[model samples]
Target: MCSHYDPVLNAQKLKQHFGVDDLPPGLKPSLWPTYVGPFLRKHEHADVGDEAVPFKELMVGSFGLIPHWAKDTKIARQTYNARSETVHEKPAFRDSWRLNRHCIIPAEAIFEPDWRSGKGVATRIVRTDGKPMGIAGIWTGWKNPANGEILRSFSMLTVNADDHSFMRNFHKPDDEKRMVVILHEDEYDGWLNSTAEDARHYLRQYPADGMRVAVHD
Candidate 1:
């Protein structure tokens, strides 16, 4: 599961690659569980009126998902990554998954642990082409009972990568390999508008050939 990543912070890249204008403020340089970051969702008015209205809108939110039933924001620590196989049944993720609150998490790179060199080593993975990654995810809102404030959050969806040529190299050898689902540029709109059942089609692993990895010193 992806627990750490660098959120895309370049304004021009965000605008040109994701078609998102007006960057949200307070996005952290890097994201971990509970960290705030930007996510792209289908614009509420996408199909309502003017054709000039962008198809997507950018919003800032916690990197981890916070369900409506969550008692507090601390749940974010454990809800950062939703397993694709059981997201529909997991309490922390089911609501957003069922409601089709699909979103795209734009990331500059994702970090994973490589244990091949006798110990765990942090490794960074990014697209070989140097473009930002549009990771598939789900978003939701939670109302704080104590303060009556609405907290928005999201979680990246992950799939089994046991057979992936590149991704299978990370993590402990004994553990099941996994990788986040990254959408192609052309599939963004289709994924955001897809129904719950149809969203499953976009949950597959990204091709290993499209990514490049570097070990951190």
Candidate 2:
């Protein structure tokens, strides 16, 4: 249930922290790349939540999910995050996992772990370098049965943490599971256009110590 994450840096902050050349002009300014909040498409004519019309490159999606079917407007309250392992198999997520899976979940940091003797001690892991961490994810569309409206949303992908990784010790010996899949710089394109096989191929785990962690400041 990795329902919460943060983009310590986003389009607005991209130019300030990262080299302007790294990103095409499209991914900046429109959306913050999260589950909720913000009018990402600054363009006047763009549709608010439909996927049929492609949005400007400058404004990324406010959410990565394009819901296949949404019974109520409130389904979003619980669908912010979907587990990578199960997503490919679930009815709600399978379509997005195979075809509609195009997204880059940018973040400055993520929360993972270290294990105490019996309990889990949480830590905030930030990138070792100043550059932002862009985790892998999937998106889909939901059509509201009641109103006949469409909404796009997303979920972050997660892989198990290894024994020596930062959150490795969090679980019992048989189960040191972790959230937050870390993508390699070269692996970006593969993930954004990932096919079902690609889902099993490219999404690699981030290094255990690849990020910095601290108590909330």
Candidate 3:
């Protein structure tokens, strides 16, 4: 149920952590589709020495699956997220989960909340440590015939809520799901190279304790 997040890491953070600098131009195009402008500016940066991929854009802001055979884009609106447990078995995510596992989803923090009014009102949630969090993700490339251009899009993974107390009260009734798949630095390589089984093995470590959380402003 991660509906909102903030990118606390600008160009510097990306560079410092992953060693990839030189951001996409403006990076606006990668923001959620149908949303207004962008949450941040785009610049290319990386640690002083590490090499990273540079693209027309960097932030894959929106979350969801854009089915390879989709006739229209609306399907993604309802599929911005896929559960980590079944991702490898689900039709939409199965392929990507096994072969396209990727990372680098930078966000200051994501928001989740409970709405007693029977309406979804997101209460911005962030980590108390105030550092940007990276949500584990997968991306796909698409082509628009009208412009003969290629576009890359991505989706975030979610897990059932176990210890995130702030999210327990507002948990989605069906699953009481609140936790997201946060890849650890040690597991990045495994995730990036995992087969279906490997992907599941590494993602299971995300729910371990020690991460911080609080209501976002």
The global C-alpha lDDT for each of the candidates, from Candidate 1 onward, is: 0.92, 0.55, 0.55
Give the number of the best model, judged by lDDT: 1
Best by TM-score: 1
Q: What is the C-alpha RMSD of each candidate to the true structure, in Å?
A: 1.5, 6.9, 5.5
lDDT of 1 by residue, 1-217 (tens): 8899999988999999998878866668988999999999998888888998888899999989999998899999999999989999999998888888999999999999999997888889999888899999999999999999998999999999999999999999899999999999999999999999999899998888899885441
Clashing pairs in 1: none
Per-residue lDDT of candidate 3, residues 173-200 (tens digit): 5556556677665654455555666666
lDDT of 1 at 20: 85
Off by over 4 Å in 2: 8-66, 112-122, 145-147, 162-164, 171-176, 215-217
Q: Which stretches of candidate 1 lie over 4 Å from their true place?
A: 215-217
Per residue, candidate 2 scores C-alpha lDDT tens digits across 3-112 of 44565334456444322212433333223234452212112333477675433222234343545664554555555556666877877678877674555566665654
Off by over 4 Å in 3: 28-62, 116-121, 162-166, 172-175, 205-217
**Range of the 10 consecutive residues with the lowest summed lDDT in candidate 2:** 37-46
The candidate 1 region of ten consecutive residues with least summed lDDT is 208-217
